[model samples]
Target: MENLKKTLIKAARKAHQVFDELKDRPSSDPIKIESYTGYASQDRMFLKGRVLEDDNIMVTKSYEELKRIFYSFKRFETDEIPGVKVLLYLDDHEFQVYTDEEGFYTLDIATPDSINVKPGEWIRGYAELPDIVGDDGPVRGTIKLRVPDSEASYGVISDIDDTILQTHVTSLFQLKMMFVTLFKEASQRLAMEGMVELYQEMSTTPVGGKNPFFYVSNSPWNIYPMLVEFLKLNELPSGPVLLRDFGFGMLHQNEGYRGHKIETISHIFRAYPDMQFILFGDSGSKDADVYLNLALEFPDQIKTIYIRHLKDTKNARRVANLINQKGEVDAIIIDSTREIAADAREKGYVSEKFVLTEVEADE
Candidate 1:
């Protein structure tokens, strides 16, 4: 009887040890969703975001440029949580989407008659993540989208670097671009002179509602927040800011990179077939090339082209020669916003009373 009692006691001790071990094991880290600024048309609303482990996530917090850059670095290096289920909500509509291998979730919903999205403003929706830390059920991440206003005369499609912000990407080996990107925060970065007012003028229509702006750049999606911050801090008009999603070695750079700008712009054109656009870019990179190609394909939809002149380079020279050659499709190699305002007045894009803020030309 004593031996049996001893065995029972030993089993009880083993059970207690197992319970202690189980109690001490760490719980899984909560998840997070990074939803990007999305856009919609009459029929289709597209949104793209990512699922990631909430631990070790860094956003732009530090005011110090050096610390800020490191924070940006760490933010980009965070791992994506793939194969997660995300529930997307747009008003009374709900959709289920699965993250791809890159932990990116894309919501391409076709709501022809369901969603009554109007233009000239942004609409807000939320994503339901797995759960939050509290008893509040699933965590919610905010998502925003813009649709074109019916009163919009023409939408503005622009490049971010050099065209809007002063990112001198044409410098030898891109030394200046690298320095500005790595050492400077978005607040420290400068936009092109007179561009803010010029773009603001362009963003308004003759009537009440505001015209939309679509910003595209060769910069990767890792700096998406930084660019968005730059736009917001500078008070630049906001729309959908699209950037390269590849080239980090996190995924193959060239996999979907071939004709990326062309493909992206093409998609935009397809989305708003009835609406026309004015294209803006710098001579640097393939902006000129891509814009010209788009003009060729969508002649009726392209209203005009404005390219900011860069330092004398082969591409710049080539664009200069090709500007006047595009027959009836007015492409201007602009030196200042005065020129833009003057021509915009002629094109009826702006009011005749809209005056230029800058008196001097940009050199």
Candidate 2:
């Protein structure tokens, strides 16, 4: 009898240990959808977004609430909820994919010939999370394809930092300044003077048509929504904003941080093989170096290179020498977007009417 009692006591202790360990385990989070802009082509469509199980997500409707808006960045930069089922609805058809380890899902789907889309036309796409998600329906997003407009003379591709927005990325107090600017309301953030005018001129076309503007930034995808709001507030030309995934760790840089920009640009080049591109970036970072290499690599596709001088005269000189050696491409360094507007007019990259109207509006 004593032996049986001892066995019962042992079992009770084991049960208690198991219960204690189970109580400490973290609960699994339900899937939440975070969608981004997608691009489509003549016969193919590419869509991308991240699936997260974040419970603390709070979106600020107004830019006035700086503290609430700042916390939204934290909610997105956290770990991706992997292995979740995601359904993408393109028009009437549907495509299914599972989130990868990083909680990112990309769909490269071939479109039926019946679904005819034109250049600059925005296609509606819905990212449907599993029923386990709390949302009522699939998250909606827009798809922009590389439909070459015969009216579009060339396409404009630009960097977001000091080139268009004052990021101070190369400043000695970069991190501190970034923290201050990032937390501020988007309306409070300052846009580079005369940049919108220049970009608008570049996006101009003959016969009341306009060229496409593509923004390729090194900023992480976590802050993408905020960036969109800022662009709208500033009245900048809208286009595909391609960004990188910084992943779970705040300090961890993605392995492709150095080459991701070029890789993305290469994809754009391939998508629209016949379209010529004008590149823009700030000289403060590796923009000059990367763009120089890109000009050489895609000599026929690159039309002109514009580098915003961020006190990096030395790098600018190197870029000019290299481009001059090539003899096929034009590269210039400027202090403001107004300089680009002047250059664009002289080079016939944009119509004189567009430049004049932009200047008048600013005045």
Clashing residue pair totals per candidate (backbone < 3 A): 0, 1
> Model 2, 42-76: lDDT tens per residue?
76666678876555543335444666555756654
Error of 1 at 131 (Å): 7.2
Residue-by-residue lDDT tens digits, candidate 1, 1-363: 989966876776666456545644454756678788888888777788887666543344556656666676765555565677888888767778888755688887665586868666666788876534435668678888888888898888988898888888998899998888766667688888888988888888777778889887777776777788889988898889887655222333455664657877887888888989999888887777788888889998998889978788988888888886877776888877678888889888888898877554444
After the best TM-score superposition of candidate 1, give how far the Cα of residue 339 lies from its true spot, in angstroms.
1.7
Per-candidate TM equals 0.84, 0.79
Flag regions of model 2 displaced more than 4 Å: 1-31, 54-79, 109-112, 131-150, 248-258, 313-326, 353-363
Model 2 TM: 0.79
What is the C-alpha RMSD, rounded to one decimal, of candidate 1?
A: 12.8
Clashing pairs in 1: none
Error of 2 at 242 (Å): 0.2
The numbered model that scores best in lDDT is 1
